[model samples]
Target: MKLHALSPLERQDLIKQYAKSFSERAKQHDEEQSFPFENIEELKMIGYTSLSLPKTLGGQGIPLTEWLKLQELIATADGSTSLSIGWHMGIVSELNQKNWPDSVLTHVTKKISQNGFLLNTAATEPDTGSPTRGGKPTTQAKKVGSDWVLSGRKSFTSMVPALDFILVSASMDDDQVGYFLIEKGASGVRVEETWNTIAMRGTASHDLILENVKIPHDHLVELVVPGKKSPSGWLLHIPACYLGIAQAAQTEAVSFASTYSPNSLPGPIKDIPAVQSKIGENEADLIQARYLLYGVSAKWDAATDEERLEMQSELGVAKYHVVNAAQKIVDRAMRVVGAQSLFTSNPLQRYYRDVRAGLHNPPMDDRTLVLLAQSLFN
Candidate 1:
């Protein structure tokens, strides 16, 4: 079946086919700490990179529900790839709703569809943490005649090895922040090879270093407003990623239980009430988390722009629940496997570490709970 231009069932069928290969390679990617270059090549060759853009932009034109559902499938195969690609997909999805300069949008959209070019933001810095915390970026942008020169370092630049363009957050002379769109070929653009975390090693999330890279004035995508921007359904990718990891855990534990019979047991341990309970718990959490993800994405996709923007708290709550549930499911799966699950060869240990990273992803649990509680008072 063709990967694009399909009904939901066909899309999912194709997704499952690609997911199998991705899963087969995921453990190796983790072990070697290598970027899944083959996986990305296949994804691009199959047109997944442009999957989120509207049909008007020569893309599949799927709604948010469909987009996120497909993303979850990808994540189930390889969480790092899902997350690494999500930065690009989310930017593409958000562009459909924003009023970016038509010339720039036209160029970027064509790059995405024809060249498989991907974009990511280099926003976080060493001096200041996440830009979500409201600190001005340390990256500096100076006007050199009609062009802008950007200089600074950016942390947490996910998929740095694969990105063709980056939305770099930099401070202007006036102290207002501007997001400058820097092409990878810019004179001073470089990747610092700084990402060496215990989780998501396949992401290649290194530091972006800039030293007076020059681009046209229009390269400035937008000026920072320094307050709460509108909530985005596209960010649902983060929750979907962790949830997919949990799904993988569920598959591993269930499979192990079904085949690994011990002398103490009459049959496979899946027959045990304790094993069944753990399986049941994982199943329950997966179902509930899926509801939160797909339901909110569908609602967000179907609503008016204002209605969608108003769903910040609800979306955050949904993300919070899914992340927490995924973490629990992974823990339960590990428990079901006993000490064996901790082995380096087992994927469950990877899932355990990967799922924990979700807690620190955007819309942090503490912030999400505050948003949930603030809505209560309002």
Candidate 2:
């Protein structure tokens, strides 16, 4: 059945079914440090990858809140898969909402619908750090005849293995940042296996090495003044991923507590007051985080462009509180499980490492504080 024809609840149930299947292989993927290529294929087969595209482009046109729910389910199964695909979903949604050239937007979306192509931005670098921090990209783009040639190395190019097109940011001669769309496997474009992080190992967030990669003149999709762009509500996917991991952690802890009776105990630890307290705490934190996350996301869906421009602070605050709460919940879950939570075989250990990576995502805690402080002054 077509995804758009299904009710929201039905669509969500379909996704949950797939997420359960993903969970079965999540441990193997994490342990082997291998990307879940089959998962992406399944998502495509079920039309999950194109759910965020505009309905005019033959997509589900899922609103922000519903889209985040899908992401959260995937993350609960495997953070690496969720994060890797989240970039693709968010970028597509953002571009479709923006005033990008219709030609470029139509072309890309068409490719996504027809060929199951994927897209993501390659923005981070070794020296400049996150593009959100306002450091100009050292990667340069020059007018070479009828086309532009780009040369730079981008770090943390997530999902490069499966991406069909990469949106690369480059410093133009005019002192503005230009985002160019380059197809994968272009001459001089290679992925370096540089991702060796302790968490989210299956994301394949390696280094993208571009040595004089050339693209058509029209491929320079957008030119923006660095640090002057509007807020992207689509970034809520980052927090949603963490929230899913947190929820998974809580579930695992509770399951363990509900069983595993010790010789000194009359029954499972879940009946113990101390363990119950931890479970209650996790539930409380998740309730608050879920409310804030879903509330802001719904507001974004109903907001006008001008109104959204004013929501930067609220967006950052949601991300800040939710991600931090996710970390806290994961920590408490581990405590409930005791030393066994740290065992390599335990999924709680994977959840612990995966949730920590959220702090390093965009709109970090320090940046969120600054946004809050500036809001008060305004």
Candidate 3:
């Protein structure tokens, strides 16, 4: 369909078509706690996986606002799949804009375009906590003859089942933290099925066990100054996913209210003043959060590199507002649906669990608040 040539709205319509089927299958995946590999494959078939690459590199090079909108649409169908693939999308988008070597960028983007390859960074560990908190990795990487051998375990390695590449963070012999790009099927690399949370279970975010996995020296992609990461506007996809989930909850609640008639009621509960008020509040919250998210995204897409560096706090602020609003929206939706929303058959239950996962994603709420405070002082 030459998706890259389509207008943003046209492309979104195409995604909506695909997402309808995804919405149908979401229940099965959630019930089985199974990863949605088929959904990922379908997205690949339509070239959605490579949409975030630079236009000069044979991709759409979609703007941040448009990219996040597509992500939200996908999340409205299935939050776990939306989140699993969003990491690949946002990481590819972010790295392509960085100062990584030209050859490396070309190689990575080529695989994405040609093979539907996926990549994600594995940084979290039981001892070190969230990578954003600046804990040094206990995972050790030692210099072998012409390669680096990494041996350690990484927690919360999302999309591990389908990942073609994993950028692992390891502490080097020199006490430096290096991100090594390790290919799947590398010697001694194994996945331990440790992800069993009540939320986002379909992400397959298992423990990645690396036992002396060796990669070429050039594959040590980047070194980090502990506790420091450039502000990532691409992280807005996290909020976008939750917003979709919230919207899904809203839809479910409204539909349920409109049709659910009890012996005690004159008609569907949707006509009740209290139910209408809850629906109104949900809509208002969605409007507020969407404006903030898209507004920040538009500003980001139009900003130059130097200007974007100063937008870190603004980006975090958007995330904070959007995620918390999503949580509230879901809660209100459950109230609108009454006890039925908690039933295993209800999608709202899944939405409730999935939205909670957003709070634990990068750029925690506390950190966002601290950044806002420090910005005023500065």
- Name the top lDDT candidate: 3
Clashes of 2: 0
Backbone collisions counted per model: 0, 0, 0
What TM-score does structure 3 among the candidates reach?
A: 0.97
Please give the CA lDDT of all the candidate structures.
0.87, 0.89, 0.91
Please write out the lDDT profile of model 3 over residues 9-62, one tens digit for every residue. 999999999999899999999888899999999898888888887777667788
Candidate 1 per-residue lDDT over residues 197-235, each given as its tens digit? 889989999999999899998888787764447888889
Candidate 2, residues 57-149, lDDT tens digits: the string is: 756678989989989989998898999999998888766565667888788889887777899999999989988888899999999999999
RMSD (Cα, Å) of candidate 3? Answer: 1.2
Provide the TM-score for each candidate, comma-separated: 0.97, 0.97, 0.97
How do these models rank on lDDT, best leading? 3, 2, 1
What's the C-alpha lDDT at position 277 in model 1? 100
